[model samples]
Target: MTVQPNIQGQAQANPVSEIWYTRCPVPTTSGIAQHFRWIHQEFERHGIKVESIRAAADQAVRNSHYSHTQPASFREGGNVPPIWTRANGQDTVVVGITWVDEEQLILVRPDSDIKTLADLKGRRFGVPKHDTKIVDIARGQDLRGLLTALDLAGLTPADVEFVNVAGGEFDLREQGERREGRRHGVVEALLAGTVDVIYAKGAVSAALVVKHGLHPIIDINANPDPFVRVNAGTPRPITVNRDLAVERPDIVARYLAILLKTAAWAKENPTAVVKAIAAETSSTEEIVRKGYGPELHLHFDVKLTEQYIAALRKQKDYLLEWGFLKEDFDFDGWILPGPLELARALAADDAIKITL
Candidate 1:
C-alpha cells in the first residue's frame, strides 16, 4: 500500500490495494467491529479491500497472524506472539490495549483428590508444547497460569513435576476447523490420568469443564489482586506493522476509529456484545457469559493507559524470564500513541456528526 504526492509535487509511493487483519477468538474491539462488518464497510468506502490473515489460503500468509510479517496488517490477540515478534526484530507498534479478564482456572478431575492449590504439591502439572515454528503461545500462557497459581500457594516450579503434553499447531484455523480441533492435549492428559493439574481459560474451556465434569481447584479471576490474574490475554494489544503506521497512518487511524465506535456500541448493548463474543469464540452465549461474566461487554474499551502498559510490561518480563523471548527491547518505545489519539478524535467527530 502507498500514496501519491501532494500539490507540492513530492515523490509518489505505490498505490494501495488491500490491507490484512487478524484477531484471536476473544472479546476484542477489533473482533466486535469485524462482527458487525463495520471494519470492511469503512475501508470499502475508501476503495481499500480488507482481508483476514487467518482465513488466507496460503499457510505462510496465515502464519503472518502469529509472525506479524505481513505489512499493513493489524493484529489484536494474546500478548505472547506479538511480544515474541517485537523481541525478534519485527517492526510493529502497539496501538492500543484492552484488558478483559477471563476465567483463568486450575482444573482437576471431579473425583481427584486435588481440592486446593496446596494439594497441587508434588503433582504432575500439564503444560502444552505446541508443534509450531513460531512462538509457542499455549505453553507460555499455560506455564504463566500454573506458576501464578503455585506462587499463591507458596510453592514453586520445583514443587511439582511438569509434564510436556503435545499441542496443536499455532495456525488460526477457520471456526469450524477450530471447533473440530478443540481436543487440547493438556485436557486429554488430565482426563487420561497422565497429569494431575492443568490450566484452562475462555468459553470453550468453561464448556469443557461442564462436559467432562472437571472441578476447578483455583479461580484466578476471583482473586482480588489484579496482578494475580495477569496472563496472556489480560492486557491484549492491538498492533500494526510499522510500514502501515508510518506510511499510511490515515488508514491505521481510521481502522482504530471503527474499533472505538464498536467499543462504545458494546458498552450500551450487553446482550449484543455477548452474542458477538459467542460468535467470535465459536461457543454458545451461555458459555461466553459464564466464562467472561455478564459485564464483559463493559471492558472492551481500548486505550494506552498506564495501567495496561504496566500489565503488558509484566507480561513481557514474564515471557523473557521463561525463555519465550530471545532478547528484550525497549517496551515503551514499541508503543505509538499517535494512531489511537487520532482514532479517538475521529470517533468523537463522527459521534458529533451523528448527533447533529
Candidate 2:
C-alpha cells in the first residue's frame, strides 16, 4: 500500500507567541510523533512552543527542515536537509533515516530493446518530475548506467533520443497533460511518441507501471550508507535570502534547534516513535518492530560534521556528472549551518525529558 502524507494543524500562537521550535515532516519520514512526545516534554519546561505540518516527501523536506520554516516556500531548494542527499539534497543527514527505494526500471513499450540497463544506449529516457530529484539521487552511483540508458545505442545524440517531458507535481500520470511550468510534466513527449522511455516519480511511476507497459532493468536497493559518499564535494545549503536570515537570526536558530532536537528524540526513542508513527503509517506494529523498531537500526542524533559535509560533496559531484547541478559549485557555501550550530550550543541546557 502507498503511504500518503497527513495534512494536520497549523500553528496558532494566541497569548504567548514566542515558541521554542516548529517542525515539518521529512518526505516519507516515518515515526516522528512517537518521539515528539518526549521532545515536547523537553520544551514544556522551557516554555517552548511546538508545531508540526505534513505533506509529500519534497514538500515535507522543504517545510520542516527547520522549525521556523513550516509551510516553507516550494521554490526554496536552499533549505534542503543533509539527511536527504539522494534527493532533495539530503546527503548530509545520516543515511537510512530516510532512504530511496526503487520500483525498478521497466520498458513501457513492446519493441523496446532496452531489456537490460546496458541495452538502453542511445535510446531516449524520460523522468517525470514527481520524484525526479530523489530518483536521480537513487541513481547517483550509476553514472556508467547513463551510457547504457540511450537505447543500447553505440550511437551518440544523433543516433538516438532523450525525450523531455513537462510533468505535473505529485501525480505522475498527469505529467504529460499538465501545464509546462508544472513539475513532472517531462513525460508528455513520451506519451506523444516523441520519446523512447519515461522516467517518472511516484504517482507517475505507478501509472507507467500499469498503463505504459513499464519494464525494469535497474535494481533499486536501499542505500544503507549515505555518509560514505560524503566528501569535500557536498553542497552546503545556501541562505540566499541574506536580509531575511540576518534580520531574524534568533528565530531561525531557535527553529533549527527545535528540529535538531526533534530529529534527536526521534532517533533516540525508536520503539515509542514507531508505535506513535504506526498511528499514521501503513506498517503494522509487528512490521515496525521488525523493520525500523530496533532491529531496523535508526539513529537519534542530527549533528552535522566533517564526515557529513564530505558526503554531500560526493553527491554534488554525482549531480554534476549528470548535468543536474554545476560542476564547480561550492556545496560548502550552500550549507547554512550557523543557525543549527548556534542552536546546538544554546541547547546545552536542553534536556531529554519526555517519555513513552
Candidate 3:
C-alpha cells in the first residue's frame, strides 16, 4: 500500500480550461476550501482559472460528500470536475486517500451507566437519517464504528436496538428554506432520551458532547485498524477526476501542491486556521478551536502505507458483505499517483513534508 508518488515527465497541455474545485463539509477540507481564492490566484500562472465551488450546505448530505455534476461538465470529453470526492469505500470513484486524523465520538447521556463497550449490549444506538439519493457514507461509517466496538465487547448488531433519528435535510428546505441541520440531530435525540447512545463526527459533534457533559464511550482514534480509523476518523482523500489527471497532469499537480501547502500552513498557524474556520463557518473561534482539540492535527500527508491499503481492502470487503456496494472494481488501478508525485516535486522544499 505504500505508494511513493513517482516523478514523471510533464505532459503538455492545450489552452487551459476553467477549473471547478469542489469541497466537502469535513473541518480541515472545509476550512481549506474557504481559502481557495488564494489558491486560484496561484493557478493563474499556469493559464488556468480555478473556481472554488462550495457545494450547497446540504449537497454533502446528498452526494455523500462528492459534488454532483454532469459527466464531462468541466472539460471536453473529460471526466467530471470533481477533483475531490467522497464515496463509500465501496464506490469506484476513489483516486487517492489522504490520512487525516479526525475522530468521531460515540457519546451517551451523563446519567447512563454504560462505562464500557460491553455496557452497550441492549442500548439503543442512534444513527442520523438523511433524505437524499446519494449514499449515506456517514451512517455506514458510524455503523462500522459501532460494529467494531461491539465486537470488542463480544456482542453484535443484533444485541442492540438501532434507530434512525430525524436529522438530515428534507424537500421543504430545498428552496432556500430553513430546516434543522443534521449536526444537532444526535444530540437532540440523546437529550430527549430517545437513544441511549449516538455517533457523531466533526466539531459540532464534539461540541455536543462537551456542552452536554455527555460521556464519550468510544473514540475512534483509539482503534488501530485502518478500516475503523477511516470510518471513525478522516483517513479519506482529496480525490480528483481521472480525465483531469490524464489530460492536464500539470494542473492536477499544481492544484494538489497548493492544497498540500495550505495544509502545512494550517499546521504552523493554529490560531490563524481557527480564525479562518470561524469566519468561513460563521461560528465563534472559540467553538472552532474547541472542536480542534489537542488531538486534532490539520496537516496533510499522502502516504498509501501497506497498513492503509490493507485497511481499505478490509473496508471494501465489509461494504460488500453488508450490501452497500453491489460490485467490486480494481482498487489498485483507481489510485492515481502522478498528481501527488508531481505535487511533491513542485512544492517548495520547506512547504510540505512527505513521510512514508
Candidate 4:
C-alpha cells in the first residue's frame, strides 16, 4: 500500500463516500468482497465505496489499506474493538458460508458408507487450513459444543485423522502454479485413499475437486431441510463497523439499502457478475461458477434475528474460554445494526416506495 501523500484531509464523503473493504480468501474467492461489490454497483448514492480485494489472510493483515474490512471468516477470535466493541447494541453482523459436520472430512465425505453426520466414529477430520476451523465457530466457535452436538448426532474425532490443506491460495496467485504446487506436490501425499473426507467452502472444495479429482458425495443441501447458519439464520448476516455507523448514519442506511438490493440482484444475474469479476482477476469461468452459491447462497439459512445474535455472542464467550480473548465481551455493546433496521424501516414505508 503506497502512502498517497495526504493530498486531502478527511476526504471521506458526507452522506456518501468510498470505503475500501478487503476479504480473506479462505477457499478461493472472497465471500465478503463479492457480497459488497453488488452493493456498490447497484447503490452508489449511499456513499458506500467497494474494493473487493481477495488476499490470503496473511496478506490481508499486512495490507490493511481499507477503511473497514470484515473479520477473517476463520479468525482465531481476538479482543480487538469492532470485534468486541458495541454501538447502540448493533455494531456489525457476521454472515458467511459454512460447512458443518461431526468430524470434518470424515463426517462430511463425498463418497462415504455412512449415511448421516452420525455415521463416522473414530474417523479423521480435515479442513483446507486452520482458519477454516476457526470460522467453524462463527456459528458458536465452541469446539466442545460442536463436538457435543456431533456426539448427540453420533460421532467422535477421537477415532480418526486430521489434515490441513491449502490449495485455494493458488486461485489468487500471479500464476496458478503456486496453488497446483500445494495440491499436487503436498496434498496428494495424503490421498493414498486412507482419508475419509474434507470440508471447505465452495471455492476451496471446488479447487481441489477440479485439480485433484476429489468429489463431494454429500451435498450439505441433501435433506429436504434448509441449510443452517449460526449467526444470521435464514436472512444471513451483514456485520458493519461501529465508527462508520454513528458518524454517518445516512450513509450507513443508504449503503445497507444498496447492499441488500445488490445481494438480491446478484442472485438473478450471477453469470454477469461472475464474468465481470473473472475478467478483472485470473479466476476462470469455472472457478467463478463453482465459487458462486445459490442466488444468495441458498444452501445456508440466513436471517437478521435473535437466533443469529445468540450465535455471534455464543462464539464470543467460547473465544474467551479458548483464551483467544482477554475477557468476555457483551453482545449488547459489541455489535451494531441501526443502519440495517433503518433501511428496513424505509423499505417498509409506502412513501419511500415511490422513489425506490
Candidate 5:
C-alpha cells in the first residue's frame, strides 16, 4: 500500500517556530546530541525553539513519541512504532538509520531447567502485553527476539506457549517518580512462575538479570548472523514528520548534521559517551558497558547504508506479518535520503574547515 502524504490541517508556515524531538532510552546519535545540548543549541542558532515531546505535560503530546501524530517532530528510536505509524498513514519519512546491537536475551530463572533455545519448546514464554493505545513495542521486540531464537534452534512459535504478561502504561517521562516499579511487571511475572522464559534487551535488562539472577538461554547479539539480531532497536531509524522534511529541508538536514557531529564526537570519547548513554538509558556505566560492550562507542556512526536499510526492512516485514501494522506500505518509498545526504555533505565541509 502506498502511503499518501497527509499535510492537511498541518502548519502552513514555511519556517516552523519550534520543532519537537524524541528518542528512545537507548544508544542513539540523537540521544548523544541531546545529552550535550547540541540539538537545542543548533536549533537556537537558527532562531528556532526545540521542544522535547517526552517532556510534554499533556499526555496527548507525549503520545506523539509513539503515534507520530504531532507535526514538525523528529524521532530516533525503535523501528516498531515508526513502522506502525507509517503503515497507519502517519506522514513521516525516514531520514537516517543507526545500527546498534544490544543484548537481546531469552531469559529464564537461574534454577530453571531450560538451558538453551531448543529447551524452550512447549514451555511458557512471557510476552508483555503493554497497556497502550498505540503499538506495543515491547511486545513486538520480545516476539521478534523469541522467533529468531526459535528459528536458530529449529523450532517455531507453535512449539511453545505464549503467555501474555500484563504490562503497565507506556510512560515516556524521564522522572523516576512517574516510572517507579512500572517496568518490572514482566520480570515479576517470570519470578512468580507465570512464565518459564522471557525476552529482554539493553542495559536495563542486563542489570535486571544480574539483580534477579536470571539465566540467559541465548544472547542474540552474540550471534554471528546480523539478521538474527534485527529487532526493534537494532537498526533504529531517525524519522521526521513529512511537513518538517518537505517544508523545511534545511532544518531536517541541520538536525541530522548535529547528530553526525555527535556520532563523531562519541568515537573519540568513549568514557564520556558511556556516561551519556548511561544517563540517557537510566542505567549505570557498568551495566551499559556490560550490555553493549566496551567498544560501544565505535558503533555510534549513523548512515543510510544498505545493510542497515535491509535490517530495518526485515523488522518492518516482521511487524506487518504479525499484524502489528495496520497496513503494508512501500518500505523503500518511506525513506527520504536527500536530507541525510545534505547532512553528510555539511559534516564533511565542517571537517575540512576544522583542519584548515
Candidate 6:
C-alpha cells in the first residue's frame, strides 16, 4: 500500500532563518535526483538549504569531501551512512525511510551450456569490480547478493573462478579527471563471452535478457529473506547529522516533509517523472521506464516502521558477519525518530497546511 500526506495545501509562508544542507545518493540521471531537483524551491521556501552536490557511497568515507561537507540531511540506498559514520567516528542518525527492493539477476549467454546455479560450478564467473575497503558498499550490493545465492545453492567462491570486469569509478571526468568510462562494462563483458556467468543490475541488465536473448539463470528477487533483501538495493534511509538531530530537529522535520511531498507529486505524475529521469541519466525512455519496475514505486514514508528497523539491524549484523565491518556499534541507537515523528504530527494538523 502507498502512503502520502495531503500536500495540495499551501506551504508555510513564514521562512525560518535556518541554514541546512541536504544531499541524495542517487545520480543526477536517476528518478530520485529528478524529484529532488523538482522540489528545490519547495525546500528553500521552508528555509532549508539544499545541497545539490551528488554524493556516492564511495565518496562518503572518512576524511572525504562528502564527509567534510557535513550535510544536515541525506539519503542513501543502503545502511551506508551509518556504516561510514561509525567507522569514521562521526555521529549521524537515520530518521526517514523509502523502501525499494531492487532486482539483481544471475545471467548466462543464450548459447552457453550453463543453465542453473549448479552448472555455474567450476565456470568462470564475471564480477564487476567492487570496492569493499573503507567505502563503496553500494557497488558491493550485487556481489554480496551473488555470494548469498551461491551459498544457498551449496556452492562457495572457491567453487568458481572469478573474472574481473571493469565497472564505473567514483572519479568523474566532468570534474576534470583524465579517465572516462562506462558503467555497463559487465554487459559488454557478457556479450563478448569474457565470462561464463554474471551478476547484473537495473534496466540495462533487464534489456540484455529481453532484447539480446541472454538467459536469466537465477533470480535473486525470488528470495524472501530480509537478510538478502537488505543488500538488494532497497530500504533507502534519510539520515541527519547528530548535531542537527539534537540542536535543530524542527529544521530536519521540515526537510523530511519536503521529501514526502516530492514523492507524492511523483506518484501523481509518473509519466513526467519517468521523462525527467530519462533525460537526466542520458538513458532512453524505455530503459528508464523499465528500470523503476515495481520496486521504486513504494511509499516514501518518514516513519521508522518496525519492518524497517528489523531489516536495518539484519543488514548491520550480516555486514559484520561477512567481515565488512571493522567493529559493531549500537544499531538501535543509530535511529532517531524525533524528526520524523514531528514531521508526521505536523502533517496531521489541518490548522497548519504546508504551502509550496
- Stretches of model 5 off by over 4 angstroms after superposition: 1-13, 177-182, 351-356
Worst window of 10 by summed lDDT in candidate 4: 72-81
Residue pairs that clash (backbone atoms under 3 angstroms), model 3: 1-304, 83-239, 98-237
Question: Taking the tens digit of each residue's C-alpha lDDT, what string does model 2 give over 141-197?
Answer: 223233333433344545545544443223222012412123224434555656666
The lDDT values for all models are 0.84, 0.38, 0.56, 0.39, 0.83, 0.57
Better by lDDT, candidate 6 or 1: 1
Return whichever of 2 and 5 wins on TM-score: 5
lDDT of 3 at 114: 92
Per-residue lDDT of candidate 6, residues 116-179 (tens digit): 7888788877766754334555345556766766887799989988787755434321122111
The candidates, ranked best first by lDDT, are 1, 5, 6, 3, 4, 2
Better of 2 and 6 by TM-score: 6
Q: List the residue pairs that clash in candidate 1.
A: none
Off by over 4 Å in 2: 1-113, 128-160, 168-194, 200-213, 220-261, 264-303, 314-330, 336-356
lDDT of 3 by residue, 1-356 (tens): 12223212334333455666544334544345335465556756556666444443544333322444522112110011121122323222333455555445678899998998878999999877666454455566667767777877789889999989654542211122111144567668888998998776555556666578887888766677655555524455455556666766666666666666766666876676666655544456665555556533454444456665565566666665666565565767666676667677667544333321
Measured against the true structure, the TM-scores of the candidates, in listed sequence, are 0.93, 0.48, 0.77, 0.57, 0.92, 0.76
Query: Which is the winner by TM-score between candidate 1 and candidate 3?
Result: 1
Give per-residue CA lDDT, model 5, range 44-153, as digits (tens). Answer: 87678999999999989999999898888999988999999999998899999998888888889999999877798899988889877889988998889888888999
Two-way lDDT contest, 3 vs 5, winner: 5
Best by lDDT: 1
